[model samples]
Target: MAAEQRKLLEQLMGADQLIGTGAQGRNAQLSITDNKVCRSYLVGTCPHDLFTNTKQDLGPCSKVHSEGLKTEYETASSAEKAKWGFDFDYMRDMQKYIDDCDRRIDTAQRRLEKTPDEIRQTNNLLKQIADLNSTINTGLLEVSVLGETGSVAMAMNEMHKVRTAKHQKETAERDLKNLQDTSGPSGHQKLQVCDVCGAYLSRLDNDRRLADHFFGKMHMGYSDMRKTWKKLSVELKGRAPPVRHHEEEDPYSAGPRSGRNQRYGGSGGGSGGYRRRGRW
Candidate 1:
């Protein structure tokens, strides 16, 4: 029964452990396999490692590496480390932008289906306006040919109808233009994806949110983390293990040497040494 319950719990949770091995270890491993080095280390800024006596909070790398790789990383030159650090965040952001574009395209396609109906409505309005115009022209001609003051009143009524139809037609055309601009191939509101975080960027002239978004902490942090992982991975794979430098020293001078004066000191003054006068 206990086994069954455990199995059920595992199924519900989808995994045996909620959290895997810590971020630092995972990232360290990934740094080796991915051939991307950690960015923090490249700039002489990485504070966490096996040798470091501090808390580890950094997350795992998307790639893979192992513990033995750390020594190779430490031996690499600063210039080499820098070369490994690439803009990984930018790639992630670009992927996000691509996703946004797909969604926008989907939405635009749905709205595009309604465009035909809008165009049809506009055409109907134009036809109505044309008919009204014809009626007004015909009425004016009748009044002019007859020279009848009573017919002038009839022409004025037709003129009023023409004006109303023209106004309605104009309104329809305006609506049609708006719809096309929003969902058409040549839309005024073009979309741009963020290079840092994959968020949809507005192309509106008045939108100033892009400036603020680029400076957001989330974007910068993700970028930095990605860069670190890339650098770590590359450095681990490309560089050889760090060579341990052993300094050569004279065995006699390994520790403090006995001074000539101390070795010669004695109880009284002599050719061999000086000695204390009180001691026999």
Candidate 2:
């Protein structure tokens, strides 16, 4: 039983290498053969036989001297000692280590068996959350852009109203300052003009004209154009347009009659005018 156990232990420790005498002895033979070949070529050999038992003049065994020894005594001695002095502690440690390794291997196998199911569950949950988050984000962006369900039109109208009020306040202040700066023959009426063309207003018709112009076709037309263009520009630019608290109407005449009519005369009649155009 002890021998069998020792055989098993040696097998575990690579018995093929530890138990062998084949390659080592063969290599020693090759060294001796090489030395002998070299000596035979370099020096002429004696014809006489070199072996003597008792009393005779003996010549050198050139083959033995030149080729050196085929067998190694010291090496054989060490092999014998190593074979005798086998360690029980090392064997016991190796057995313990192998036992621990087997336990770890079993645990790893169990973990691997459960991993695929757990991974599938985790992936499913992650996919569900990802889809839910995407839907929610889409809804929120739609509400923010096109406004809410019940109040979409209202929200747009309210925003336009606020923007218009702010613009009127600014224009009024500029007109007040211009009036303060210089004197003119039209008295206080020098301020009344087509805000678009800067043409002077001479009558109530012109005043009505300007008011109609202010809250009329140009306003609605420009607002519609802005809705389309602003959407396009914002998508391209990847950011919101800049905000100014108040903006003035374009002082420089906005192109020609052709330019104004082309943009302003689409489908919906515009109530708000070119004054509605904001900064980029």
| Top-lDDT structure, candidate number | 1
How accurate locally, in lDDT, is each candidate? Answer: 0.41, 0.35
**Candidate 2 global CA lDDT score:** 0.35
Model 1: how far residue 173 lies from native, Å: 4.4
TM-score of 1: 0.34
- Residues 192-224, model 1: lDDT tens digits: 444433344456635367556556554454345
Per-prediction TM-score:
0.34, 0.22
lDDT of 2 at 145: 67
Query: What does candidate 2's lDDT look like per residue over 54-115, in tens digits?
Result: 12223333332222331221234644423321111112212232233335434433432324
TM-score of 2: 0.22
Which segments of candidate 2 are over 4 A away from where they belong? 1-80, 92-100, 112-114, 148-150, 153-280
Q: What's the distance in Å from true for residue 171, model 1?
A: 4.1
